[model samples]
Target: MSIATLSATPPPPSSRAARRTGRLFALTGAFVGVVYGYDTGSISGALVFLSRDFHLTEVEKGLVNSILVCGSIVGALIGGKLADALGRKAAMLIVAGSYAVFVALSALAPNVVVLDLVRFLLGVAIGISIVAAPLYVAESTPARIRGASVAAYQVATVAGIVITYFVNWGLSGGGHWRWMLGLSALPAALVLIPLLRLPDTPRWYVLKGRTERAVEVMAMTDPDVDPRAEVAAVSAALAEESGGSARSLLRKPYARAAFFVVGLGFFCQITGINAVTYYSPQIFEEMGFTGDGQNFLLPSFVQLASLAATVLAILVIDRLGRRVVLLCGIGTMVMMLAVLTAVFGTGELSGATTWIGFGAILLFTAAFNFGFGSLIWVYASEAFPAQLRSTGASVMLTADLVANLLIAQFFPSLMAWAGAARTFAGLAALALAALVFASATAPETKGRQLEEIQGYWRNGGRWPVAPEPREVSPGPLSPTGPAGCAERGA
Candidate 1:
C-alpha cells in the first residue's frame, strides 16, 4: 500500500487466486449497475400508481421522470474530476452510498415535487457512478477479457431492469409504487460492503505517482503478465501528460476519441431507449394491453429480451469486435422502429394486431442490448489516453444524459401531441443517422491494451498495433473466437 516501495507487501498469490480477486474487483465496482437499472426502470411501473396517488397531469409526469436527468448532468460535470482526485474505488463508494440514501428519500417523498427533488438527487448519484464504474472496470481487468469485464456493468444494468420488471408485476395488484422505489435501497447498501474491500485501480495509482502500488495491483488483477512491465508502460505513457482537464480533451490528438465517445453516447440516448425504459407500460396501454397487470407483465418480457441480448453481447464483444456489434445493433433498431412507425401511422394496430408492435419492440430491445447498451461502456473506458479518460467519459455521459433528459421530460407530451407513429419515425431517423455515424467513426478496441489504444488516436487515428506474442499460440479461449485473441503486446 506504500507509495514509495513494496517493502511491506507480502508475496503475490497463486495465479488462480489472483485472477479470482481480479474478477471480484471488476464485478464489485460494476455492482453500481443495479442502481442504474433498478432506479430508472422502477419509475416506469411506479409512475403508473404514483401518478394516480399524486393527481399528476401529463406535464407533471414528464417533470417527474426528467428531473433526475437534470441532476445527472450536474453530477456528470463533477464526476470526472472527483474520480481523478479521489481515485476510482473511493469515488464508487461515495456514489453507492448516495444511491442508498437518496433513493430511500425518493420512496418516502410527501408530494410530486418532493419526489422529483429526491429522484434528482438520486440521479446525481447515478450520474457519478456512470462515470466511475466503467473506468474502474477497464482499469482493473486485463485486455483479453476487457470487453466482457466492462460489459459486466451493462449486464448488471439489464439484469437489474429485468428484476425490477418482475418486482413491478408483483406489486401491480397492490399498486405499491413506494415499495418498488424503496426496494432499490437494499441492493445499493449491500454493494457498498464489497466495494469497500476492493483496491483502487492500478491506473489511478499510476496517475498519482504510486507506481509500486500500481505494480502490486497489476499482479493481482492480471496474473497472465508481468506486473512491473505493465506498470512501467503505463508510467511511460503518463510521463509527459498533464492533468485530465476538460480543456485538454479539445486538443487535436484527443478529438477523434472525443467525437466517437460523444456521438455514440448521444445517439444511444436520442434513439429512444429511455422513452421505452421510462414508459413501456404506458406504451403497452396505448396498444390496448390496458387496465390489467398485463401492462406490467409485458415489459418483464421486453427486459428479458434485453438481458439475454446483453449476455450474448458479453460473449462476443471481445471476439466480433466493437464496430460490428455497434453497427449491427443500431441497424436492427432502425428497421424495427420503422416497422412500428408504419404500423401505428396506418392505424392497423388493434387488439391482437397490437401483438405486432409487441414483437417489434421485443426485437428492438434485444438489438439495443446486443450492441449499443453493452459496448458503449467498453469504448468509453478505453477510447481516451489514460490522462483524460475520466474527463472524456464525463463529457460523453453528460451529452448522453442531456439527450436522456430531453427524451424523458418530453416523450409523454410528444406522445400526446405527435402520436407514437411520428415519434417512432423520428427515433428511426436518428437511429439511421446513428448507424451511419458509427460505421464511419467507431474504431476497434478488441484485445488491445489501454496503452495500445491511446496510440491509435495519437497516430492520426490509425492503429499503432503491435505484434502478438509467440507464447500465446493461435486458438480461441473461452471468449476469443477461432482467429484467437489479437496482438495484445507492444
Candidate 2:
C-alpha cells in the first residue's frame, strides 16, 4: 500500500450540530476512563489508611486489592458479548449507573468483606467500560482517524490516574479514605448524563438489521458528509451475514485471528503495565524513597509520561507502522528492565543508581505507551474479518482481563518473594517474547484499509491486487519501449 492510500481516510466531517454532539461522546468516554483509573489507583494510597483502620495484615490488604482484578476477569470475558447482544449504548448506561452505586457502597462498608465485594463489583463495571468504550469509538470513527480517536480512551485513563493520585493525597491526610472511594461516583454520574444522548454504533445497527437506522446514525456521526459510502462499505462487508454469532469466532476462518487478538490482549497485561500504573507509588517507596510526599509526586510524572508517549504514538503509528513500533518499544523495555535488575540487586544502589532506576521506569512507561498501549486495541479491532469482529474482541478482552487478574492477585507476593527489581525483569522477559512473536509474524497494516487488513498476511505480505501505484504510469509501451526503459540505448 502506498502512503497516500493509508493517509486518505480522513476523520468524518461534522456539522456544527454533530460537532457539539461529538463532545458529549468524548466526555462520556472520559468519565468511564476516570472511573477505571480511580478504581485501579485509589488503593495505592488508601492501603495504608485502610490497614490502620481495619487492623489488616499485609496479605489481607493485598487480597483486597486483588479482588477487583479477579472480578474484571469474569467481567471482561462476558462484557463484549453482552454489549453486542444488548446494544453498546444500553450496556454502557447500565454499567455506568451500577458502577457508581456499587463503588459508593464500598466507600461506606464497615469491614474488609464488604469492601472486597464492592471492589469486585466495581471491577465488573470497569471491565464493561474497557470493552464498550473502545468498541463504541471504533465503530463511530472514520478509518483514517480511528487510531487517534480510540487512543482518547488511554488519555482518559491516564488523566483518571493522575486525578485520583491528587485526590487520595489530599483526602487521605485527614483520614478520609472513605471519601476517596466515594468521590469516584461523581464522574460515573456525569458519564450517564451524556450517555443518554449518545448514538449506538453504526456497526451494531447493521448487526441488528436496521439498515435505515444504521445510515441515519452514520450520518449523525458525520453530518456534513453523506453516509452512503460508509454505509455501503459496512453493508458489503456484512453481506450474507446474520448478526455475528459468538460461535463463529471459533471457526477455521476466524480461529487464528481470534487467537492472535487474544494473544495480543494477554501480552498487553503481562507487560506488567498495571503493576506500575496502579502501584507505582508503593513500588517507589519500597525502592527506598523514604518521603511519602515525594513518592506521591513522582508517580504523577509517570502518568504524564504515559500520556505524552501515547500522543506521540498516535502521530507516528501510521507512518512507522505497527510492527516496527512494537518491536522497538519492547526491545527498549527489556534493556530498561535489565538496568533495573542490576541497579536494585546491588546493595550499593543509591544516589545515581536510584536516579537511573527512576529514569528507567519512565522510559519503560514511554515505551509501553508507544507500542502495546496503543496498538493492542487497534490490532484487535482490525485483525478479524468483519463477520467476527465483535466476537474476536470479546475473546481478546477476556484474555487481557484474565492476565490482569493473575498479575493483580500475585504481583505483591511476587514482589515480596522476588523483589520489585526481579519482578520487573520477569515482565521484561515476557515483553521480549511478545516482541519476537510480533516481529516474526505480525503483518504491516500502515497504509491498508481496515477492511483490507484482514488479508494482510496472505500472499507473502503483499496485496494480491497490486497496491495503489506509487509512481506515475509511463506512456503506453512503444514497440521499442521508452529511452529510460532502454537505459539510454545502452
Candidate with best TM-score? 1
Model 2, span 1-490: residue lDDT tens: 2112222343444576665655556556666876787777877777767778999865676688778887777677777778879898887897789778987898899999999998888888777777787777667765544555667777878778878777776775476878878888777877787788777877788777666666667666766555656766776766744467768766665566666778878988887877776567667777667665667677777777877887888888889998888777778877887877777777555678778888888898888888888888778778776666666777777788778767776777788888876887788788888877777666777887965776663334444574342344556653235554455333
lDDT tens readout by residue for model 1, 1-490: 3334555444577888888888887777667786678987999999999999999988999999899899888777878778889999888988889988988898899999889889888888777877788778878887777767776777888888998999999999999999989998988899989888889988889989787888888888887887877877777766645567878777888888888899999999999998889899999887767664999999999999898898888788778998899889999999999988977887745866688889888999899988888778678878887668657777888888889999998999989999989989999999999999998888887888887788888887798656644454444463244344443431
Clashing pairs in 1: none
Q: Tell me each candidate's RMSD, in Å, in order.
A: 7.4, 7.2
For candidate 2, the per-residue lDDT at 254 reads: 58
Clashes of 2: 0
**Please, what is the whole-model Cα lDDT of each candidate in the order they appear?**
0.84, 0.74
Model 1 shows how many backbone clashes? Answer: 0
Per-candidate clash tally = 0, 0
